[model samples]
Target: MTRKAPDAQTLSLMLDNVKFDSNGLIAAIAQQHDTGEILMLAWMNHEALEETLQTGRVCYYSRSRQNLWRKGETSGQTQQLIEARLDCDGDAVLLLVDQTGVACHTGRKSCFYRSFTEDGLKEISKPEIDPGQLYARPHKH
Candidate 1:
């Protein structure tokens, strides 16, 4: 069955019931429903939470950058929110999305392409697009 878009009140009620982690941060998981692909995981603060709901865009709190960020803001591979759900504990979120393009900043459909085995971590698939072509060159390096 399809879920009609919930009103703000309902959304708020849903949020109120979830158990947020101690740090007031929740884990948000991005997935592509059509392909059953797990894209990436990020943290979400309350502001990021509100931003994502209001914009229908996936936003997360970047631990490294120490700011709220929308995925693919610079890369143009935005994840359009199809649906968002909180885990039973309310400490985690799952976002079903219609991905605009590659979900991984590394230019793959998913960021979880690396596999760890006895030989250690390995790249299992070639990037679907060249990240450098889609995003500006990194300044840190």
Candidate 2:
């Protein structure tokens, strides 16, 4: 089915049904339209979700960092949001974004590189740039 952009009222109504996780979170999945390629999946708190809609930018709650973060804030591969949708269960979200560059923090175009196979797993994509070179200094081993 062709999903049209939801009106603000519809978006608000949809938000009410979302079931936040134990930590008051929901998973947000980003994807590219032309390719139907999933970019990355991250968590979002109520605040983050609202902010993302308000700003037209994808923002997610970083569990490890314990804060809200705008995707590509550090990497410069920011995703300009195209649309956001809640799944039937409302346990997850799907974001269509106009991606600029790499989407994964690993410097890959997408986070979903490892594909399961009968033999094992295999990488499907290569890094666009070295994370250390594109974002910040690498941690010392």
**Number of the predicted model whose lDDT against the real structure is largest:** 2
Q: Residues 1-141, candidate 2, lDDT per residue (tens digit)? A: 443445779668867998998999999999996799998998999988977877777889999999998877776778777888889898999998888888888889999999999989998888888988757832221
Candidate 1, residues 25-94: lDDT per residue as tens digits? 8889999978878988888988788778777878899888889888877877888788888777668899
For all candidates in order, the CA lDDT equals 0.81, 0.84
Clashes of each: 0, 0
Best-performing candidate as measured by TM-score: 2
Looking at model 2, residue 17 earns an lDDT score of 92
Candidate 2 Cα errors over 4 Å, as ranges: 1-12, 137-141
Candidate no. 1 TM-score: 0.84
* lDDT agreement of model 2 with the native: 0.84
Question: For model 2, which pairs clash?
Answer: none
